[model samples]
Target chain A: MEGLWALISDDLPALQIAVPLLAATLCVLIRRPTAAWAVAMVVAWSSFANAGVLLHRVLTTGTISYVEGGWPVPWGIELRIDLLNALVLLVVTGICAIVLLAAPRSIDAEIPRDKQYLFYAVYLLCMTGLAGMTVTGDAFNIFVFLEISSLSSYALVSQGRTPRALTAAIQYLVMGTIGGTFILLGIGMLYMVTGTLNIVDLANQLALVGPNRTVMVAAACIAMGVGIKLAVFPLHIWLPNAYTYAPAIVTAFIAATSTKVAYYVLVRFAFSIFRINQTFDGAHSSAIAMMLGIAAMFAGSLVAIYQDDVKRMLAYSSVAQIGYMILGLSFANEYGLTGGLVHLFNHAIMKCGLFLVLACVLLRMGSTRLSAFAGLGRRMPLTFAAFVLGGLSLVGVPLTVGFVSKWYLVLGALEAGLWPVAVLILLSSILALVYIWRVVEVGYFKAPPEGADAITEAPFSMLLPTWILIGSTLVFGVWTSLSVGVASAAARMLIGGGS
Target chain B: MIEWGLYNYWVVIFLMMTGLYVVIARGNLIKKIIGLNIFQVSVIMFYVSMGKVRGGTAPIEAAGFEVYSNPLPHVLMLTAIVVGVATSALALALVVRIKETYGTIEEDEIRRIEADEDAS
Candidate 1:
């Protein structure tokens, strides 16, 4: 067993990507939904296990850098994992595994049986791309993986029941393509000056190059490009519709994982590649990020309150939640960065769990409209109970994952002496409360729609995964050792001990 | 004064702006996709142009060749081109489906149809 483990440990990085990619190809050939689902299940869980092992290795032995095909650094593609990406990898793959466990049932109710195999195939490809993006250390390689995941996502979005899904996917494609091109342009400019595509090499060379016009333009291009992918406020036009119209499983997976990965990229670039002091004429980047975050928080929460469609409401709320993460990042201190990083994990679990609840509701009710949820708390007791827990987490109630992150955020703001920003953080929580209360009021207080007594609880398959996520919100909230500990460590690494 | 020798950049900027303009200005789905392709082509050109070295030959190994054009950007651009084509193909496919279901590919018409659906 020790010998086998030794052999596998060395190649964990490659296997992390290879497993899903190979399994996706196999899924295409299998052509049976159940068989494809089984393939996906095994692949997702194994990748999750792979990420677990990788994270443990990173935590123990420090960063892991694996060169592709036995080439040297600055020439070969590297899959590098430090504390930050390790946490992100675990969040992404772990959420994917749990969501996949609950996916087959919802998928059956929504997608046609004939195309189910294709759906699984594309889903695995999307996972492969996301995992690849998280692991790679090459600049151009990130773009390749970004497109791979994005193309599959566009296809996945179009799989929704209504014709609007097609329009939404197209809009996403256009905006996403422009965003991608801007990134490429930025990388091209970086290469023009630095002459290296490797991230660490670029960072070193950028420091040597100092503040130059070309690098400044490159930084702006990359920021805006990643901002679009991150769905940061003004660039977030494509998100709500895309999430609103996508099939339930696709929405859940993308909502939880994709933005977090994009946030990882932004952080990687902002701090790791271009040090915070060097970006955008020195110190303005943080100011810009803080301003946009505040705007998104207020705007997104206000818009979410008015959305009658529950899924769309959650989508808008996602925009607001992204604000909190960016707000934490803009603080540029240890506590602020830690708050941001932990919120990444916490939000992933909270939002994915909430969406899973909606998926259960969608599977039974055939809609996620506000009216459809009337008296749903009584009819689907287990599912709505899960919803209430997830909702409380969203509102940052005590003893939930949401509050832990917000606490750190508030502390970070106070430490930074940005009292108004701290107050704004608290103010936004009330907005979250208002929107969540709207749903609760409709779900519990209103009478059931006529002849709706036949609705039963979601199948155990769905409820189990939903509760597992909801339960973790409380578990991690109370026991902050793992989540908060790793996050602060990662924060220290990103800030490089200055704080 | 602008250096005319850097004319490749001028062309790149021109194409990029034109492409972006069309993508934003045109309402037809196919036109939008065409604009996207054009925009991608400009980036591809930008990369390819950057690979060129003064007084250099192709990146083939041979005796007496002191300077060779960098081959990496060309290779990376090849990948980008393929991604662009894939995106265009997918966008066009979506347009076809849109036509099939909604019977119009104009953005305004589709929005009108959807708004009506939302209302009723």
Candidate 2:
């Protein structure tokens, strides 16, 4: 009850998680679609409001930690609101607001009317799960919320009203389970060495057991687990089909937020939660980081160039973008870490905008095939414009957010004297241009096949969100202050600060 | 024949890896689920095994005991078991759906369908 009042007192972190969870259960009891949506809207708005306040609080006062049930961590569950978690909280909650507002229409169209209320309930549940995972400081709590999200995600994807969606959900389920198991195993490894589940305590205890081979193996296991969850390169086999067959709104949410959260976990582990002890006894860490990251970059981009379906191409591109984030991380420098952080937020926006545009096109064109988008530039100018803005960001065009990320990345590579890596980054951008231009050429130059009638542009519900992100992509491109400042501060909190 | 804190961990690690390899190598979908079950159980085993302290009984507080198997990891693992159950249920549901759609539970056949899907 006190935790409940703490939320009422504007503690922010509790409100961020509790609002959606309580609202989700209440929504289920209501059993009315409109009422469910109203509740979900309130919950999402509150979550977003709470996230913004939390970000400001973290920026002003450093990390704000609350011990749930009034028990301190290592003995009880805790929530830590730091710059990193707050940034993620804003992105997650912000997307939830848009997805929820946009959901009723798409959900009714794709899902049966009878099942619409369940859809909202599950989506909100998944939102609560994702938010809880980010806010919680306990390793085991991460797993709990991770499962909640994955479980609901499978149900959401399976509600695609196509048989293929079932298969996609199965593949995702198998891989997600494996990933979760690996993470749990790694957490177990840490607990065996340190005897604590609190992330802060685990980091402190890691120093005494720093030299053990088990610790190194634990790191590798954790990396691989997060890698799979993020669909990093080779582990990305389930991605294309899953995104392709899923409900478009489901694709938009998962593509935007899911892998990025896992990527945050990986960065949290390697950079903040465990980096302190490594510097004293220079562990051979950089080698593994380089090996996995560069491989993901090279392999993911190459695969993306060959996909014919628009959604598949975008899915492969997700892997390539994840590669860039991972590559920046492997640089293990201040600039590299900042670039990585910037790319995380940038990728979320650009990818969601890109996928939302595709969702709009899917609504009109009846397929996501590149051939169908012929002359879309003329027919649906706004959608195509949003697509182009997103594509330009994808290709790292100058004076865009993508360019800012690449500029910092190239600097980091040069700082490390990794000239070859700088070249690979350039090459990957070319590959991105190739795939993006495939659609551009089809839309602008190619003629629509005979009997294909002009279709209406996607509704304002869809177009507005795409444009908001497109405008932000341009705004952030010129206004590097926000992106660069937050990223550098976050990098310090990750790499230099002990916590 | 009793050993120290380190010995207890070795057996758990060995079982965990063995389960992990089975999940990696197996191709049948149901068998993969079983492999995953073993894998998740191994993780639970590892965590619960770690919670054991030397000369500790169950974690409930009795007046005279100096050692208590850490209560936190145990509570956490109980939650994890619930997570594992949810994962298995979702996995099984997906498998059922895949079987209904593709008419095959073997992963190779599913891959063939996916490849066919891309080609067409």
Candidate 3:
């Protein structure tokens, strides 16, 4: 049993990807949608368990490097686990497990009966892709896994019954392809200069080659590509529609995981692979990123204020929250980077909880329009309570994970002597408060429209997962042992420099 | 002489810009997809060019062929080609669905129709 545990521990990273992919294939073979969902749930929960084990291993043993097929690094594909990847792996699989738990009931409600199994299969493929992207050490392999996740998400987005979903999927495909192509072009340029595709190896070579035009161009291309995927301010045209038009559960899962992974990729490239600050162009890139981050914070929130649809509003809020994450990254110090990394976890929980609450409301109300939520506080008290709590978290209210993230972010800024940036961070939360308060006002104060009084609370399954995530925002908010400790360790590892 | 050696990059950049132009300028969905294909093909070309060695033969493990081309980029390009094909297929399928519902494949037309629907 000890030996078996050792073997599984050594191979956990590969299993994290293989299990979900194998389950995805098994789901295709299964006839019943319920059976397929069962297969997915078991795989997802097991993956979550495996990810927890990996995180524990990393926390204890430091970095674990797994090379495929026993081939050494620089020759074979590598999956390296450090504190950062381990933290993200736990969050990604954790969110996958929570969302899958809530999926069956919502999938039945939203997806066609005949196609439900296919949705589960594709959903697992997406999980496999996201996990693969997070763990891989090869630069080109990141592009491959990126396409896998993006293609699966495109399919999942288009699965909704609305014709608008088809359009949204098409738009997403175009934009995503452009992003992927730019990344590939950038990769090719970097390879041309360094003659290597392995990330750690490329970092070593880049250190010797120093900064040049080709390297800067490569960095620019990669940044823009990831920026589009991360939905940084002006390049965020593809996000709101995709979020609004995708099916409820699909929106929930993708909203929680996809852009978070993209942001992770951005951090990997800038800090680990390129070491952007070491180059001559480092200050330029950081400045531009900071500018865009500030803009996205304001613009995404301001746009979120006017959205009539609850899902769309939350989607815009996600954009704003992504800005806060980016702002932390741009600070380039341990405290700032810790805030960024911690916000990744906090925002995923905060946003995913809110979307899951929206799923609950959508299941009961049949519409997510602001008007449909009138007097929902009384009609569906538990679900609305989750929403209110999630909204408060998004506004950075104390005793929530959002407040913890913002506190560190403000500290990081003040440490950097950027007082105005700190002020802006606080101001944006006030903006967040305004947007969230709009829904609260309507939910609690307004009268239920005609025929709305009889609408019941969401089913227990949906509310359970929603409240679990909402509760964690409070738990991690106060404890700070796990989230903060891990985030600060990951930040130290990143800022300490070198891959 | 210097410009001549860098001609491949020039051609690659031109093709890339043209493809992006078509994608951004054209309203027709099919044309946009074709443009995307062109853009991706330019990337494929860029990568394949990276592996090229002057006077190098095919990257076979035989004895007298000393200056061999890099095989890694070729392998990566194969994966990239597969990704491009998958994206194009998905895009075309979505375009088919868009046409079925909106009665047109033009971007502006779809927006206009949606706007009018929203207005009414």
Q: What DockQ results for candidate 2? A: 0.70
lDDT of 3 by residue, A372-449 (tens): 889999999999999999999999999999999999999989988899999999999999999999999999999998
lDDT of 2 by residue, A1-499 (tens): 8988565754567777777888878888988888998998888987888788888888898888888888867788789878877888888888788766666666666887767778888889889888988898988778788888888888888887677888788778878888877887788778778878788888888866664777776777787787788887778887887888898889888888888788788788886656822443333566566666778776777788888788888988888888888878888777888888888888888888888888888888878888879999988889998999899999999978899899888888987789899898998899899889988988988877777665878888888877877788888888987678778888876767456
lDDT of 3 at A73: 85
TM-score of chain B of each: 0.94, 0.84, 0.94
Number of backbone collisions per candidate: 0, 0, 0
Inter-residue clash pairs, candidate 3:
none
Task: Name the better of 1 and 3 by lDDT.
Answer: 1
Candidate 2 Cα deviation (angstroms), residue A114: 1.4
Q: For candidate 2, what is the recovered fraction of reference interface contacts?
A: 0.86
Would you give the TM-score of chain B in model 2? Answer: 0.84
Best by lDDT: 1
Docking class of 3: high
Report the candidate with higher lDDT, 1 versus 2.
1
The best-first sequence of candidates by DockQ reads 3, 1, 2
The TM-score measured for candidate 3 stands at 0.98
* Candidate 3 chain A least-lDDT 10 residues: A276-285
lDDT of 1 by residue, B5-76 (tens): 789988999999999999999999999999999999999999999999989999898999999999999999
User: DockQ for all models, in order?
Assistant: 0.92, 0.70, 0.92
